[model samples]
Target chain A: MSTKPASERATPWALVTPALLWTLCFFVLPFAAMALTSVTAKDGSFTLSNYAQFFENPSYWRAMVNSLQVTAIVTVVSVLLAYPLAWILAEQVPERFQRLALMLAVLPFWTSYVVRSYSWLLVLAQNGVVNRVLTGSGLFADPVQLANTRLATVIGFVHFFVMLLTLTIFANLKQLSPSYRKAAADLGAGPVRTFIHVILPLTLPGIVVGAFLTFVLAIGDYITPQILGGNNELLMPQLIMMQIGRRGDFPLASALAIILMAVVTVAYLASARWLKIERA
Target chain B: MRAFAKILATVYALLLYGFIFLPVVVLVLFSLQATQFPIPPFTGPSTRWYAAVLADTRLTTGLLHSILVAVGSSLVAVTLGFLSAWGFARFYLPGSAFLRGLITLPLTVSYLIIGMGLLVLFNRVGIPKSLAAAGIGHVVVNLPLCFAIIYSQMGDHQINIERAARDLGASEWKVLLLVTVPVMAPAIFASFFLSMTFSWDEFVISFLLTRFETTLPVEIWNLLRSGLNPKTNAVGSLVFGVSIVLVVAFELLLFRRKQS
Candidate 1:
């Protein structure tokens, strides 16, 4: 490409200015404002009281812990279910079937996330499909209380997200050469050993990327837990919503948002490191 | 051994497909169930919920608002994305790598943060959070995706062709209008459709920003919070039906093009 003259240089800037300004005004400035609001006291004094409250209060701590616990469980389950499915799609499928399989993998992602979560609500409610099946099969005498439980929330998260994880991992798998697997097989390594030594290490970057995405999304989700989680399983996003909507405590919500941002940033940094190492 | 592996793969594929479609199947089936409960012992099929959903003027208006926003945002996003991608592809700009990274960084940020951040910014700037503000926020969130798609498609071959056309005395604008743009049509179309889908389905930002004219997902959220109703399923089924048709049509068209 040739360099443009100084007069022409303004063209790219002109083209990019709207998007740049949008991001600056909408994305960068608001977070800064939110951070500022977090430290500002109700009486107009700068104070660390909001952070202190968040840390000192057992309910806040419990909410954070529960959010982390649910995120971890969902991440693991999504990966576990997605990996085998990705492997089968990548290694075992015929070329002609690949596109269909990949399309199937991405279809769930195209649906509205809230609608998908609501579908789970309908499926896991006390008289929902799972209980109906269980009772009708004579496995239970009555419908199971599945909705509003921790189990229901986790199940919803996995159901909604596992397809995305599979697609990411499958993309990574497709980029790997088949010869490595063939060489391991020729050396008499079984499928399990081959996967453990060869495929697993090679695909770690995708795993890291997928897991990070799933965890961040799962933790940031307010709607899923708000709809699916009963009283006992309140998560951080829901807590932030409550502060903002119910209690009208913008400072507390802003403080909690900052904390959530920090946690996400830390997790992301760690995952980036693992991804870089895997790539190396 | 190969046959057995093929069988296993087929079974896995079936299961994966089942996973994707299960909820949709359940929603469609239960939308017609006479029993208010989601339990599978269906008394009979019923269209009462669909009638109820059609009767709700708020939801219908919300759907219309959603369509308008999606179209407006996608157009803005794609136009911006095309310009930025062209700059990156055709110019030797400084800090291009950093610019690329910055463009894509929004994908990592949660919608919750984006929604809150936009709300605060709009509030400070006296933008009066409305449908336009929501559209602007969506464009920001979607621009990176559009840029990525367009940038990837503006490959070396396409760039070289455009350069050749320019060297033959064609103006920069003419080259873009005649040669480069046509070559990148499929990518532009795909990105447009994707942006439309994203903006249409977006919840958090619209929910946060819209005071009067809420988008479909926001309306759906409000309805869900009020109470669960079969009417919600009717609306969902309509959305799902439209999306499935569009996606399937696009898939078939793309497949045929690839084959040809």
Candidate 2:
């Protein structure tokens, strides 16, 4: 790859220069500032105070734990709901319906995330539609206080993410040969056995990727929590937002952001390793 | 045996579809509700909120600002992305993989972080936060997406075609303009539309980076935070409607091209 002529080499660099410059100016430089800010003190000198503040505080650690918990719950729920839907879309549906279904799945993502979160707020508020219907239909005696709870955050995350998971898994499933299933059945494997032994293993890569993607988005999400979590929930991203905007504590916010980046990076690395294992 | 699986599949599909569309349905319905609260006791459908939204000068100005920024940023980003992608595809370069990774790194970072980083950098450079800065911020965020889309579409054939053109006595610039670009037109168009959508819909950077000149989403956020109003719903519906139309138009054009 490196044996190319100098003129040849200049072309690729020329092509990449604009993109590289954009990243350097906006992405790399900004992050470098953020990292510097994270370590800087109120006295305008370099210090470990921000990191110390984040690590020493139980509430900060609690927010991190809460982020992980919510992300994990959403990832699990999304996968559980998405797997069946993906299978249906990939296998049972006709081609025309499949395209329509896939479009419908992705269409919601095109809308404003804030608008979507607000819709959830409307649906899950005490006298919101879900409770109103439940009470009207005699399903529940009282309206559930569903908003601002951890449950609401998790539900919103699942709602926002399940589509992406289904799409990923569906794409993976579409590539599998149908003959493999038929072959399994002919060899005396029942539907359940064939699905478990054959289909499940093959789709593991999609599951891992889908799960990681969902988890990453969920963990990094601030808008959903701010709108839906009301006064109670204080996730990591929300904490970082507060530190930066409300509290005007740039150092603390930078520290919190770095922590979040580290955690998400670790999770992504683990998922990448898991994907390798699945492939092997 | 297949009957049971088919039944299960239908049920799953319906449930999934319901989950995806439920919020959108609610949004459209609630936009029409006379009551301030999203839950409806059925007062009656009215265009009162739409009237209110139309009357708000701030929201109108915000919408105009959003359109300008989205258009400006997307145009710059897509053009640069196209040129860079052409360079990469035509020229053999060391560290191309590293370059690709660097381009994609922004997508991984939270938008909030990006916003913060940009804010800090702009502050250091003594550039006041404004609409122009916000547009630049959006360009940074979207450039990678445009590059990836264009580069992938350029494909392996781009190198051969460029080489052939050059060997056939075309200048480097001429080969790029004539041979490389024409072939990558669809990808370029796709990148433009994608970048437009991204810039149009982006909220966080625009929200953080602007003071007086805000985008549509920032206006929507302010309205939502201050109070629940029908006007907000009206604006939401309008934005959603426009995006849907644009997406459908693009899809139709692409589909027709595929058929022909």
Candidate 3:
């Protein structure tokens, strides 16, 4: 690069300064503040007791375990449910109708997310549709408990995320050249074999990306658990919120948040390779 | 076998569609209940809950607050994003990659963490939680998204037109205002709309940062926490209705342009 005049050099700085300052003040500074707070003790001494409490307490660890358990269930279930739906739309639906079909599929996503969760709470209640159908059809001896459970929470999550995964996986499936399938058939691979060997591997990136999104969102969510999961159990977000909301304990909340972030970091590192763009 | 497979796929698609729409269907259905509880056995179709929701001062005011925060924050975010994106795309700035990464990093972090971080910082700095604080949080969450969208669309193709304008004796301001802004209008609009969508629906940050005047989501949360009532359903339905209108408008207007 040639040497530029001072004024010319400052132009980019001037343009970018406002955004950078905002990011620095709000995003970076607060994160640093949280990091600092995480290591501080309640008694005004520098101690890792906040983190120690999380490491030491069974209940605290249980909150993490519950979060992981629910998030894992939601992600895997969403992927499983979404793959075939995406495949059908990609392969079966005519091109003319595919866009319309996809639009309809994700239409519920337009609704407020909090409202949707609350809707699920009602839908899964004892006298809600599922139970009513079961009893009305004599499929069940009596109404079984469904509301305010891990199953309900997972169902609510899977509902929202399945649409997300379908979109990602549908894009992945559509990106496949028909020649890949044709070539596989020419090489004596059956439909299943072609799908397993060629299609699945190709779409893995999309699935991973979508699943990663689900993991992050579901784990950090305070609403879904607070709404549907009920007070029976606590997820990481709930625990973090509980610390801040009930106790006004910033240090403990910060520690829990950092731990949660560390989990997401581990997840990101694992999926980083697949997420990278190919230059070609 | 072919017929059977086709039938199977059709059934599966229908089932999935039903599953996807079930909650929304229930939400709308029960929003009309004459009964107090929003759940179970169909009651009389009543418009009273909707009326009640409209009449409720807190919910109505919260809706206005949501609109204000969403529009206010989105404008700030989009302006900042557009400027930075233009600068990075056009200029030869050192460490630009690092700076862009810094701006985009918040997209990876959860909104809850961002909210918590802001809460801690605000507490430490003695900045009282208010609508402005929540708006700042919204900007923090949205700025990255807007920046990424605009930056991605800032291709080299536009540079030629910009250079032509500069050669015609247009200053940097004139070039940006007339040439660059017009060319990048689609990206800017998309970013603004997307930012609006996110900020409108966003909860935790606004929930934590604001106390007396909160956003619609937090208000709905308050209603939900108070008890299970059809009025909550009515409010949910109302938001859903407005969102659908916006979405349809976006599809017909913006999406058609993209396709063309």
Candidate 4:
């Protein structure tokens, strides 16, 4: 593309100014402010006590540990459930019906995400359908406590993330040339071997990208843990919110949020090689 | 063997679909419950709870607030995003790649962090929380999405036509307004529509940034905190219904146009 020589230079910069300024003021400036807030004491003096609190308090540090554990579990379980489903849709289902199948598979995602978590609470409650099924079948004498637990939180996260992983993985699968699969089979590979040695390796980028996204979103979410986890334990986001909501501790919340962001940044770096926004 | 495999695939698909729909099924089914409890022994199908939800003044205000914020923020996001995308696509400015990356950077950050950052910033700046504050947060969240979608659709084919229009003595604004806008309408509309949906359904930012008057999700969350009632179910069902209608309409109208 050729740029016009003189006046057009200013025009392009003028056109871009609003968005650049908006992002700078709202996004970048806030981030800088948060970082500054994180270091400042409540008395308006510089201190490292906020960071110290996270390390010294077991309860606070436990939230970070719990966040990582739950995020890992959700990412792994969602990818496991989603990949085969994506495979089925791409290779097993006929090409024409795939779109409809995929849409139906993910249709429930259109519901409000907060509402979705709340709905899961109902479904997993003592008198809910799962318990009723278990007791009705004489498998147990009483309902197992399902709602307001880590298990419930995981279920909610996985349910939503499975849809996302399936979408990414399915797109990746569709992009593979048929000749690759044919060659794998012709090279004396069975279906399992072909998938393991050929297809899975090729689709690893999609899996990594989706899994990393799941990690970032799941860790940062306040709703799923708050509504489902029942405060039995806190996650990083909940702890961060509690600081601001109840205590009016903006400094602590800023510190906690920066910590949470740091975790996401580390995850991004680990998966950065495979991550790209452009559809391949 | 092939028949067995087909049967297994069908069963797997059915099971997954069942898992996906179970919560929503329980949600809608319990919304019609005549009794207080949302579980055990399906009761008389009643619209009483739905009536209660509609009558709630706070919730109705929240619904309106949600619409206002979603529309207002999405308009800002899409407009700013479109202008920047056009500028970047049209020009070879210094560090253009780095600048574009800076604009797109927030897509990686979580809304909780974004909200927390803004909450801290607003406190430092002495800005009070309001619907406008929440709307500003929404713009921060949605702007990157709008930029990426609009940016991706700005192909050289459209640029050539835009140049032709400019050569015919159209001013920059005129060419942009008359030609580029029409050409990129699909992407623009899609991004706008998508940003609206995200903003409408968004929870955390509005929850953190707003005071008494807030968006629907935050209000519904408050209702949930008060107690587990069928009214919450009714509200969720209502949101689900409206969202489904909009999505289906978008599919039929906008996406179909793109396909053809």
How far out, in Å, is residue A258 in model 2?
0.6
Local accuracy of candidate 4 as per-residue lDDT tens digits, A195-259? 99989988887788888889988999999999988889898998998998899888888888888
**Of models 1 and 3, which has the larger TM-score?**
3
Off by over 4 Å in 2: A1-11
The count of residue-pair clashes in candidate 2 stands at: 1
Calculate DockQ per candidate and list them.
Answer: 0.59, 0.65, 0.86, 0.86
lDDT at residue A121 of model 4 (Cα atoms): 88
Q: How far does residue B136 in candidate 3 sit from its true spot (Å)?
A: 0.6
Docking class of 3: high
Worst 10 residues of 1 chain B by lDDT: B33-42
For model 4, state the Cα shift of residue A233 in Å.
1.2
Q: How does residue A68 of candidate 1 score in lDDT?
A: 95
Higher DockQ: candidate 1 or 4? 4
**Candidate 3: residue A61 lDDT (0-100):** 99
- lDDT, candidate 1, equals 0.84
Query: Local distance difference test, per candidate?
Result: 0.84, 0.83, 0.92, 0.91
Q: Residue B135 error for model 1, in Å?
A: 1.1
For lDDT, candidate 1 versus 2, the one ahead is 1
